[model samples]
Target: MKKNNNKLLGVVATVVMAIVSLIALFPIISIVLSSFIPSGSLMRNGISFSFPWDELTLSNYTYIFTQSAEYWTWYGNSLWISALMIVLSLFFSSMVGYALAMYDFKGSNIFFVAVVFILMVPFEILMLPLFRLMMDMMLIDTYLGVILPGIVAPVAVFFFRQYALGLPKELMDAARIDGSTEYGIFFKIMLPLMGPSLAAMAILQGLGSWNNFLWPLLVLRSNDMFTLPLGLATLLTPYGNNYDVLIAGSVMTIIPIVILFIFFQRYFISGLTVGGVKG
Candidate 1:
């Protein structure tokens, strides 16, 4: 009786999960199907439930890759910007987190409070002022202009500090007794243990930077400087149509992030779990 009940529960759980997965995947499946259909067919059918009766065409992809060098440039820019932001965020956030976790100093509570306070403030509110500051610095339409503001993210600091606080204090003291400098202890000892948090922070920062439309759109004037999201946005025709190409662009934009998440999914999951659990 007990064994039968357990088996029944497992079957029910599996069915429930499958349904949930289908619900989540429906939109992605629809987009991919839509991307394969001809532009004219898309206009005629208007996003059908049935699969494409027509053959899949590579034209959409080929058009972007070969015909439009601008698309590739935008893709490359998005990739590099996201990568750089992840690297810088890791370094700065780790240092800040470590200090907050390990150090006892003047106004430490006040500083931590301030960091948390900043996290509550939405980025949209600061855009105008931040843009003005970038203009004052003559950084508009520059890589440094877009990237510099990204480095000082408060959420990264918060995650790092929480993760670091959960680490053993004795490890730091042991390093100190071994004639290790503060920086040495942090770099060589603490950072290795911070892999999960860093991985989590990297994914978050990378995704945020990659998908950032508004900030890049505002700062980048020329079409040459546009990132993936910005470039994808430009695909919208003046008539508010071009579903096939738009879907193709969306797919192109999504592919890199999907590949990244798949490769680092284990690390990402572990990082998120640890950061949340420890905090």
Candidate 2:
């Protein structure tokens, strides 16, 4: 009787989860379907599960691909900025985190505490001071201005530090005894061990940088310099809304993030779970 009950419960749980997954995916499915819809229909109806199958057309995708010069430029800016941010952030943040976890140095605790504190503080509070600093340094309206402020993000540093704590310190000693330099040990020995953490952080950092809007909007003056989020917003005016291009472009924007996750998904779960275990 107990065995039969357990099996029944498992079946019920599976059905519940399947329904939940479908519910979560409804919006994504609606958007993809709506991309094939005509601009006039989209403006009139907004997005919905119901589609006029006969009216669905590929013109939206065509318009975005061929005529949207500004769209491509925004896409390119976001791509490079996101890519640079991921590489630079992982490089610097991991090192800082590793040092804090491995070495017993002066003021290390204070630094870690500061990182945690900063992580708790909202970005809005820091934006004013950061803006003033960027202006003084003449980095405003530049890629550097956007990328520099967040290159060593507090959350990344904290995550890496927590993950690094669980790494074996015996390897560091072994590398040092073998006459390896500090940089050599980190690059050759420690970094390889951090693959999962790196992959997880890459996905997270990429998503954050790609979707970022406010800071880019505040700094970037030129239409060409605008990122995808900023550029997409400009499509809506008091006179008109470019729903067709907007929906199609939004679909295209999901592609890179999807690809990033697909490639790293094998590590994503383990990385996030392991980092949290130590903290």
Candidate 3:
């Protein structure tokens, strides 16, 4: 009887998860289906999933491939910026987290409180000051202007600090006893243990950087410097819009983030669970 009940529960859980998965996938499936449809149909009836199988064509993708070199350039810029932001953010944020979690120094807690406070404040609030600072530094219209602000994100730091709290400090102490320097102990012992957190942050930050529109919009003045989202947005006008290119280009944008999630998915959940604060 117990075995039968357990089996029933397992089957029920599977069904529920299947339903959830389909619900999540519905939009993506819609986008892909719509990407193949003609732009005229889209303009007539904007963004619906009533699939017109007979009217579907590959011209959207073909245009992207054959006619849009600028689209590819925007894509490349987004890719590199996201990559650089993720790499720099992970390294610096983890280091900050480690210091906060493992070290004891005057004003450390105060500084952490400041970090949390900054995290609570919105980036929209910071944008004006940041933009002015960028101008002063002469980093405007440069990739450095875009990349510098995201490299040490407060949310990433907070996440790493919370995740680091769960790590065993004995390893650090032992490494220290064996003549490992502070840098060596962190790089060798703590970093590997924090793999899940790093992977999770990498996915989150990478996705954020890739999809970022507002900040990039503020910094980037030229069409040549546009990221994917900004570039895609430019397709619209008071006149007829480039629905085909927009749809196809938007579909292409999802590929990198999907790949990042696939690679780091194992660590994503565990890291989130560890990093969550309890009341």
Candidate 4:
């Protein structure tokens, strides 16, 4: 009787989760379907299944490929900026996290506490000060301006620190006994074992940077330097709302993130699991 009840419970849970997943996916589906509707039709129908399918056209996509030079420019900018931000953030955040977890320094504990505290504070409060600093550094309207602030994310540090705590110290000791330098101990001995955490951070940070709007909006004055999110928002100018372009553009933008998740799907789960486990 217990076995049968357990099987029944499992089936009920699976069906419930499937329903939730469909609900979560409904927005993306709506956006995609809307992208096919003729320009101004979505504004009129407000996204109903009752709209005639035969009237849908591919001109939205056609505009993107052939007539959307600005969109492609924003796409390329996001690609490179996100790619660089991931590299720098992973390197610096992981390095700080590894040090905090492994080494006992005078201020190490204090530093970790500071990181936690900073993580608790919201970014909105820091924007003015950060912008002032950016001005002092003369980084405005540049890729560096968009990316510099995220290079050492506190959340990434905390995640890496927690994950690194779970690594075996014996490997570090063995590397040290082999006359390996500290850099060698970490790079050669530790980095390879950090596959899951690295993959998770890359995906999370890449998505955040890709979807980010406000900071990039503040920093990028030049249209050519604008990231995808900002560029998408630009479509809704006071002069006229470009809903047709926005919907189709948004549908296209999801492709890269989907590809990233597909490529790192295996590591992403394990990474989050391991990184969240206690010291």
- The candidate scoring highest on lDDT is 3
lDDT of 4 by residue, 1-279 (tens): 999999999999999999999989888888888899776777777777576688779988888888889898999999889889999999998999899899999989888788778877888998999998999999999889889888878878888888899999999998888999999989988988987789888877877788889899888998888998999898876443577678899998997667766887876565445445554
- CA lDDT of each prediction against the hidden true structure: 0.82, 0.84, 0.85, 0.84
Error of model 2, residue 50, in angstroms: 2.6
Q: Estimate the TM-score for candidate 2.
A: 0.91
1 or 2, which is superior by TM-score? Answer: 2
Worst 10 residues of 2 by lDDT: 270-279
lDDT by residue for model 2 over 1-279, one digit each (tens)? 999999999999999999999999788888888888788887877765677889889999999889888899999999999999999999998999889888899998788788667777888998899999999999898988999987867667777887788899999999999999999999999989988789878877878888998899888888899999998889876444677678899889986667766777866565445436545
> What global local distance difference test value does model 3 have?
0.85
The most accurate candidate by TM-score is 2
How accurate locally is residue 89 in candidate 4, as Cα lDDT from 0 to 100?
95
Give me the runs in candidate 1 sitting further than 4 Å from their true place. 1-13, 238-245, 270-279
Worst 10 residues of 3 by lDDT: 270-279
Ranking by lDDT: 3, 4, 2, 1
lDDT of 1 by residue, 1-279 (tens): 999999999999999999999989888877777787676676676667877766678776666566677777887899899999999988998899889888999999999898768878998999999999999999999999999988997777878888888999999899899999999999999999998888888888877898888889879999889998888788776553555557777887777668877999986675545436544
Please give the RMSD of candidate 2 to the true structure. Answer: 2.2
RMSD of each: 2.5, 2.2, 3.1, 2.6
Q: Which pairs in model 3 have colliding backbones?
A: none
* Residue 126 displacement in candidate 1 (angstroms): 1.0
- TM for candidate 1 is 0.88
